[model samples]
Target: MHLLRIALASLANRRFTALLTVFAIALSVCLLLAVERVRHEARASFASTISGTDLIVGARAGSLNLLLYSVFRIGNATNNIRWTSYEQLAAHRQVKWAIPISLGDSHRGYRVLGTSQGYFEHYRYARSQPLRLREGRPFAADPFEVVLGAEVAEALHYRLGDDLVLAHGVASISLLKHDDKPFRVVGVLARTGTPVDRTLHISLAGMQALHVDWQGGMPARGAARVSAEQARAMDLQPEQITAVLLGLHSKIATFSLQREINEYRGEPLLAILPGVALQELWSLMGTAEQALFVVSLFVVLTGLIGMLTAILTSLNERRREMAILRSVGARPWHIAGLLVLEALALALAGALLGLALLYLGIAAAQGPVQAHYGLYLALTVPTLYEWTLLGAILAAALLMGGVPAWRAYRQSLADGLSIRL
Candidate 1:
């Protein structure tokens, strides 16, 4: 305890340098921890993007491709499943519910999804949490009514009763605009921190009506053009859809259903367990995640090196102090112990300050991050892994301090009672 007091007093005498060292370490520590937290949260968010659905069925394609287009709204599907097949599968006894997904439309830059009221009823994310509306109700009988996702509504500044036109294609800058089939926003879903938030939802009938008058991928001219009312009056049953999300009646039936769907003779189809596909997707990204973590580790090492440099540089100026202590009967090990204590003190202070900064940053950026990126950075206590990382940092600091401690020990023994420069 006496040695700790002396070491702290000595650091107080050089408060400016010590503070700078601590601040440097604090910034590095904060950065490392922040990256780790984001990585963990991103993985969790990615895995929870679509949950409670036992299987995702799509027209024959790679599992990753199907997962991307179906859940992520990424690339276009190679082929669309026939609506007849969807009806047959949905009516299967093993299937509890099925939500069909129709893509290839966009509102501004956001993807427009054509689904039934079943999507709003059964689609879930983040631990089976059901979709909730922030305002208004889900689209009812009106084929022209639409429901806006949280991000779509917030980013485009749309509200209930607002009318918007969707383009025929999924391009960000689409040439073929479905101007005649204007849809009214009847509902806005709450922010879900998933791809769902970045999508615009509409009924399957609405999707068919948009392109009902278009032939050969081009809109009809003059009398051939169908107005919204005319299209609504006609049958709007969808012929094909991009994918289907299925919930099984029992968890044990997931594999059986998947096998059956894969072997279906009605049409070529692929069914993948959502959990398996998610794990596969995450593994593909593991390399980049590890690379990021390694980079942050090097940053932390750089900060520790800076601390080592500061301590070693101060050694010459403090030689006289060490000699005085030796003259006053201080043992060489005592001097070494003091230097180690100083390093530990700096590390502890830095770790604490870094934790404080992390929480403050999370609190400040939580809203904007979620608003723009759909990544909710929860302000919660550090997990066990984080605590372990901090502990490792302290241990590394202690190990690094040994270098200066050994130098101080040798110098104090040799320069006993003598002032060196």
Candidate 2:
């Protein structure tokens, strides 16, 4: 107890240096916490996108490519599966449900997905979760009606019943337009923190109706356009679709179902286990994740080293003070305790301050992340991993400061009361 008091008193005498060390540690802690948050939330967002669905089927291609197009709206499919292929597998006895996704267009920057109401029923993201309607109901027999994801609605400032037209592929504007087609917002889905948040969902028939007059990729650039009424009557045959989401009747059938679809010679196609494909994607992405971790480690090390250097450099300036303390009853052990206590105190103060900074940063960026990044960073209670990270930081601080503490102990024992300052 006496040694603790001496340590506290010693730190109080050098309050400026102590505070500087604490703040430096605090800054590093903030960065470490931030990286962990981003990594955790990213994994959560990816896992949530196809929670209920067991498999994702698409034209034969890499599993990662299929996931990116079918679930993430990241890139277009290299080739679309035939409607016959999707229908054949969707009708399989082992299949519980199927949701077909037709992709080829966008509205402004938001990807457009042509699907059926079955999507609202079978498609799950995050953790086998159902779609939650933030406003309005799912499409009720309205052909040109569309539902906006939370991010889409917010970014585009769309409200219920707002009319919008498709932007050819991803182009915001083009020389030609589906002059005959437009859709109105019938519903708005709540945030899912997935690619769904960046998509505009409409019926498959709507996709067909929009391109009915255009025989190929585009209509004659300066040519005559058809009327919306006429498009409503035209045959909107969805000859092909980008991919189909699969739900198995039995969980055990996943492997057999995947095998069946892959071996089916009806047409070239692929079936991907959503979970396995997800793992593969993460593995491919593992390098980037590891790199981020390494950077965070360096950030922490730099801060700890800086604190150590500052205190050690200042230790030389305090030789006279140490000699005076030696003249008093303070022993070498007492001087060592004081240095160690100063380091611990700085670490504790920095940890608390860093937590505050983390909260403020998350709160400030939450809305923007939800809107632009299609990610919801709810300030849920901290995880055990985060506690572990903080513990490690404090451990590093102790080890770093121990070097200076040992040096001071040696000097105090040597100088005693008779030595020169």
Candidate 3:
């Protein structure tokens, strides 16, 4: 108890340097924890983005490529699967339900997804969390009605019944606009913190309506243009679709169904288990993840070095103080213990402060992060791994404490009592 008081009093005397050391450690700890938390949450979010689906079937292409374009909206599909194939797969006896996704157009900057009501009923995220409407309802049977994702509605400031035109391509700036066939916002979906948050959903017929006047990806010059009213009467069946997400009747039949689809004689196709493809995608990202972790670890090491430097520097000024303690019957080992305690104290303070900063940061930036990056950061308690990290840091701090403690222990009373004698 007495030694603790002495340590506290000594730190209070050099509070400026002590506080600075604490602040540095705190910031570093914050960065480390932030990296870890964000990494874990990102993986969780990505993995859960399209769960409950047994397979994602697309035109024969690399599994990673198909997953990227269909799920993450990260790239363009090499080729779209035929609408006939999607129909066949959806009608398969072993299939529980299938959702068709036809991607090509864009509303402002958000991807326009052409899907059926089955998407609302079957598509899920974050482990069976179904899509729900925050305002209005899902797009009705009308071909011109559209549903906006939470981000799309908030960003474009669209309300129910507001009409908006979509661009033909995914580019931010495109000359081809579907102005002749504007879609009215019928619904706004609640935020899912997935790619769905940035999407604009429309019926497959609505998608076909936009391109009805076009041939070979352009408006036919001499061809008659169909108005919205006329498009309602025209055939709106899509000839091709980007991908299909399927649920299976039995988990045991997943591999057999996948093989059957891949071996289909009509057209070359690939049926991939979502979890397996997701793992492949994550494997490709492993290098980047490791890079982030290494950078954060280095940052923490720098902070610990700074604390060590501050303690060692203070030791030189405290030699006389140590000699006085020795004269007062304090053993050299006691002086060492005091130094160790101070280091541990700084580490402990920094760790607690870092946790405060982490949660505060998460709370403050949660909305913006989700809005811009589609990353939903939840403020939660530290995990066991996180606790382990804190423990490792404290252990490192103790080891670092030994350095200055040893210096103080080895110093003779003469070094403190005699100055330049």
Candidate 4:
């Protein structure tokens, strides 16, 4: 305990350099912990995006590609599934429910998803949490009515009864505007921290109405246009849809249904298990995660190296102090112990400060991150792996301190006596 006090007092005397060293390590530790936390939480958020769905059936393309466009809204679908196929599958005896998704439209960079009221009834996310409207009701009889996600409304500063125009493409600003077929915001959904939060929902009939004058992805020259009111009187059944989310009546039927869908004679379609696709996506991303982990580890190593440098450099200035201690009957091992304890102290302080920094960052950014990116960063206690990481950092610091400690220990009484300063 006396030696520990001596070590503390010595560090306190050089608080400036000690503080710098501690801060360096603390920042490194903070980055490492933050990366791990984000990686874990991101996977959890992605996996929970759409739950309780047995399959995501779409036009035959790469499974990852379909998952990306359908769930994450990262890319576009290669082709669309015919609406007839979606209807047939939805009416299947083994299928409990089906939610059709129509993409390829955008409102201020947010993807527009055209679906039925069954979306709110059957779609689930984050542990089977059902979608709920924060205000107003779902689209009713009006073909021009729209529902806004929490993020979309908040980002665009929209409210119930606000009129908005959707673009023909996914770009934030497009020349192909559907201004004539403006939609009134009827409902704003509660935030779910998923892709749903970044989406705008409208009835499937509403989607067909917007494109009544377009042919082959472009407005036909001199084509007679159907006004929003006239669109209601016309057939609005969609010829094609982007994808269909399926819920099975029985879990045992998943494989059989998947095979049946894959082998359908009418058109080529693919049925993917969300969980499997997610796992595969993560597996493909493992290399990038490893790269990030490696970079953070190097940052930590650099900080430890800085601490080692500071301690060793201070050794020259402390020679007289060491001589005085020797004259006062301090042994060589005592000097070594003091140096080792100082390194351990600095590392322990850094680890604690790093933890504090992490929580502070999370608290500061949690709201905005969820609001903008639809990522919910949970503020939970550190996992066992994190504790292990802290322990490893401390252990590495001790090993690094050995170099200065050995130099201090090897100083003989004669060497202390020879100190002229």
Candidate 5:
């Protein structure tokens, strides 16, 4: 207990220097933990995007873009596939089911995904987890019912049986609307913290019905608006759609099915494996990710370097104190133990403080970050990598602490209680 008290008193003597060391380490821990969290979540979210789905088919363009737009709702489609192409692909023997997605619309800031009932049943995300409606139920065959994503419902404060007018384009003001036919909100999905949380889902028939009277993307330019009763009589056949999400008959047939899909000649279309396409996207951003990781490593190095500087600079002033301790029947090893204990305390305190900050950051940014980027930050216990990271930090602290201990040991041997200032 006496020796422990000695360690505390020594550290308290240089409170400013000790605090600086702890602050530097805390910042380094923050950087290191952030890098670890992002890397782990990126891979996890990417892989879990389309677990049960096997293939994504769309008009000829970059497969990566098609995957991003159709699965992530990230960008607008470059081109639309003919409706005939969707029917032809859906007829394949290897395909268990297929869901057509029509884009080019939004409600407020949320993307509008016009799909079929199959989408609600077959669509999966976050580890083969099927979509579960949180409130009310899925949209009906009725042309005016809408099923909103979790985020859309919570953000817009809509409940079942509410009314929503689809925007003409992806903007709030697109000079177009199905003003004559507003959709009734029938469902609200549970938050999955994925892109699905931001999408407003509606039946493809509803989308086609909404724009039946408009010709060539304009509102018929002052033509008579058709009533909802008249729209039911008209053919709501969609000529084109943005993409098709697919399910395979069997997991083993995925590669073979992908090969067949790419060679499909019904129209100029491309088939992509969502997982593979995600890797392509990540590879594009890999350089930036690598740079971030390198920067974090340097931050950790900076912290260790600061500890070394603080100790070496304080060694001269501490030399007399070391000699007094040696005269009081203290062994060189005892002085060394004191340095080690101080280093351990500083490292642990900084780590705890930094971890607390990380938790707070995650909580504060959880909603906005997920809404904008579709990336969820979890604040659970540290993973194995983080434990290893902490170990490395503690190891560095010990190494720097040894410098002061070694200096004091040699000084005490030569100047035993002699004040040779």
Candidate 6:
């Protein structure tokens, strides 16, 4: 306890340098923990993006590609499956429920998804949590009515009953607009921390009505144009769709059904187990995640090195102090132990300050991060892994402290009662 007091007093004497060192380490520690937290949350969010659905079926394409477009709303489909194909598969003996997905439309920057009411009844995420509306009910009966995702409504400041026009293509700044067939927002889905939060939902009939008058990728001019009322009066059943999500009556029949779908005589289709595809997708991204973690580790090492440099640089100025201790019958080991204590003090203080900073940052940025990125950064206690990382950091600091501790030990012994010039 006496040696600890002396070490702390010594640090207090050089409080400015000590504080700077502590702050540097704190920033590095905060960065490392922040990166780790985001990586963890993102992985959880990615895995929970879609659940309850057993298989994702799309026109024959790479499994990763199909998963990306179908579930993630990323990338365009290579080919669309015939509506008849979706109906046939949806009616299979083992199939419990199916949700057909129709893509290729957008409102502002958000992608528009045309799906059936079964989507609301059957789709789930984050441990089988059902989709709940924040304000109104899901679109029913009227084909021109739409449902907005939480992020879409919040970012665009849209409210229930607001009319919005969807663009003809998926581009953020699409030139072709479906202005003649404007849709009213009937509902806003609660945030799911998934890609669903960034999408706009509409009925398949609404999607077909938007492009009904278009011929050869161009909207009909003058005499051939179909008005919104005309579209409502005509048949609007979708001819083709982008993909389908299926739930099975029994998990045992999944493989058999997948094989059957892949070898269908009508069209080339690819059916992938959602869990398997998600794992495969994550494997492709693991390299980048590891690289990011390594970069943060190097940053932490740099901070520790700075602490060592500060302490070693101060050792020269404190040589007289060490000599005085030696003259007062202090052992060389005592001097070494004091230096180690100081290093440990700096590291512990930095780690605590970094933890406080991490929580503060999460509290402040939680809303914006969720709204913009659809990533919910829960402000929770650090996990065992995080504690382990901190323990490793402190251990590394103790090892680094040994270098200066040994140097001080040798100097104290050699200098004895004489002050070095």
The lDDT for every candidate, in the order shown, is 0.92, 0.82, 0.90, 0.91, 0.83, 0.91
Which digits, one per residue and each the tens of the lDDT, describe model 3 over residues 1-421?
8888999899999999999999999999999999998898788777887889999999998999898889877778888888888889989999999999999999777899999999999998876778889999888778999999888889888999899999999998889998888899989998888888889999999998888888889886644887889999989999999999999999999999999999999899999998888877888899999999999999999999999999998877788789999999999899999999999999999999999999999999999887565578888889999999999999999999999999999987777564442
Clashes of each: 0, 6, 0, 0, 0, 0
> Which candidate has the top score in lDDT?
1
Candidate 6 lDDT by residue in tens digits, 152-176: 9989999988999999888889889
Give the candidates in order of lDDT, highest first.
1, 6, 4, 3, 5, 2
- Cα deviation at 14, candidate 4, in Å, is 2.9
Clashing pairs in 4: none
Candidate number with greatest TM-score:
1
For model 6, the run of ten residues with the poorest summed lDDT: 412-421
The candidate, 2 or 4, that scores higher on TM-score is 4
Tens-digit per-residue lDDT, 1-421, candidate 5: 7877987788898899999898888888987997789787877777777778888888889887898889888778888999988988899888889999999888887889999999989988877878888998888868788999888898899988889888877876666667778889999987777888889998888888878777788775454777788887878879989999899889899888778778777667788888888788888888888888889989988887787788778777777787788778889888887777777778877787778888888999878766555468987998888989888888888887888778766664576455556
> What lDDT, from 0 to 1, does candidate 3 have?
0.90
What lDDT is reached at residue 400 by model 3?
99
Candidate 6: residue 287 Cα off by (Å): 3.4
Q: Which ten-residue region of model 2 has the weakest summed lDDT?
A: 412-421
223 Cα displacement, candidate 6 (Å): 3.7
Candidate 1 lowest-lDDT run of ten: 412-421
Q: What tens digits encode model 4's per-residue C-alpha lDDT throughout 1-421?
A: 8889999999999999999999999999999999999888778867778889999999999999999999988889999999889989999999999999989999889999999989999999877889999999999878899999998998899999999999999998899988779999999999888888899999999999999989888875554876788888999999999999999999999999999999998899999999899888989889998999999999999999999999999998888888888889889989999999999999999999999999999999999887565577789999999999999999999999998999999877676545555
lDDT of 4 at 83: 84
The lDDT, on a scale of 0 to 1, for candidate 6 is: 0.91
